[model samples]
Target: MEFVPEEGKHLHEDCSTLILPALSIGNVGQLVADLLISSMGSERVGYLDDPNVLPCVGNDAYGPFPQGDLALPLEAYDSPSNALTIIQQRSPVVKGMMIEFAKNMADFLAGSGKKHIVVLSSLDFGKWQKVDMSSGLQIYYLSSSNSNGTDENCEQLGWKKLQEYDPSQMHWKYLSDLAEGNVTVEDITSVEDELEEENYYASLPFAALFSFLKAKGLKVTCLLCYCSEGDNISDAFQLGDAVCKLLQLSHPTTGIEGGKWRVPLSWMSVYGPPPDVSIF
Candidate 1:
């Protein structure tokens, strides 16, 4: 009830898009947003949780909302860099706060026409164990990071673009771009500590988000691409890689395939009809 649709607008008609893994988890979604010409649904106005806890201390923040509880939002992205971040916002985790925020988002979504809530996230080998705290289920990851949704990278990679960017806008990016398996990682050590563990990892933001979206009667799905977490548990390479594919971009070839892209003529044919067709 706190959500106000635009005048002349129906609550069920507005499409709110979410870019995932904003802090520690949203690297992939950020890339897709930039290339696809999409943006964060609405840069948050207030945050349910406190900042200065961990990773989000430097990257994400939440302030007072003159509007309402629904307005207390978690706004990510401070730099001129535009990757649609779904950052975890912290290291020690704050799933409860994020869940509260998601609850508010879901309530808003409940009365709206959000066709689909596409969540972007990747599995951190460590959190993977916690989110599932499992009895032995192996998770496999495939990173389509280099496959471009379209040929947008040709424009994104130009030196001219990077030069004009504001440094503050892209703080998480430099690290995310760094290949996966670069961060120290560990697996879930206890099931009883699931809540405590996840709070510490806070990597389950995507799943919680999906659940919140569903609670609001929204259709939701999570998309992922594996990161090269070979040794590093927090590496977002796969997420980053998958994002590139979603947006159809290429990394400047450092003779690397994970981050670099090479879209083929055949790939372009996947979308349009037989090269020549104007349907009435």
Candidate 2:
């Protein structure tokens, strides 16, 4: 619904595989983007860049607000989604430009004849940890499912994303008694819960997009690589690893030459300082 039909340009010959990552809080999406870019390269994958347009129903920032500029909209970087409080050494990556670019990419994937789209992500769950920031998070496997739950997605492509989370297994809740202090302990847990939920919802946009794709009969697969809540994990590294796994999962044994169709080559331009694959 958000995307306009036949708005995106064709980047590849045909059937270009797409991988979209969340690229926010947990860095799972960013990690996936980095990995796909590194694997695909720039020349091969075309970046979907769309001009400024009035939003479908929301503001250029997080979501549609009641009021504020409806005419001559501002650039995406100026939106609230890009605004971060400077928590540590990071800033919000999902802003106006990134989002529109993603939309254009969706247009390309849908109309450009590429039926397969894969979105990569990393997330956190509330699991108690002893040392704090050293807990391992559970990784979830969510595949897109159609209304019938038995379309081509299930038969050929294997679509099945909507799965219930087992709080007992996936939810990691730290006991309050183990807190370092009354203030720090409660603060940590609350922060963890917020991050966990945010990461989970971050994947929703892609899910929504995939659902849209399904309406058009396009097959979309979302691969999420979860990170532990407090392990001080490298989301970037995990993304790369996830990319390799996704590629393998989509197709077994056949390397890139085998027509596995890795992500388009836009990695170098956007995600700079590529990870030393050896380092991962």
Best by TM-score: 2
Candidate 2 Cα misplacement greater than 4 A, ranges: 1-10, 39-45, 51-105, 127-138, 145-162, 165-203, 228-233, 249-280
Segments of candidate 1 deviating more than 4 angstroms? 1-26, 34-95, 126-192, 196-203, 228-280
lDDT string for model 1 (1-280, tens) is 2533333432222224334443333343434433222222223322324332233333112221122222122333211133232322224335435444555555654554445455654444443332332322222221112221112332343211112112122221211221122321122123324534434322245544554554455555455433333322223334444444444434433223453332222223324556445653
Q: Per-candidate TM vs. native? A: 0.37, 0.44
Clashes of each: 32, 21
Task: Indicate the residue-level lDDT of 57 in model 1.
Answer: 35
- In order, the Cα lDDT scores of the candidates are 0.35, 0.38
Candidate 2 lDDT over 51-107, as tens digits, reads 532333222121123244221121111101211000010123243333333444455
- Judged by lDDT, which candidate is best? 2
Q: Distance from true position, residue 111, model 1, in Å? A: 2.5
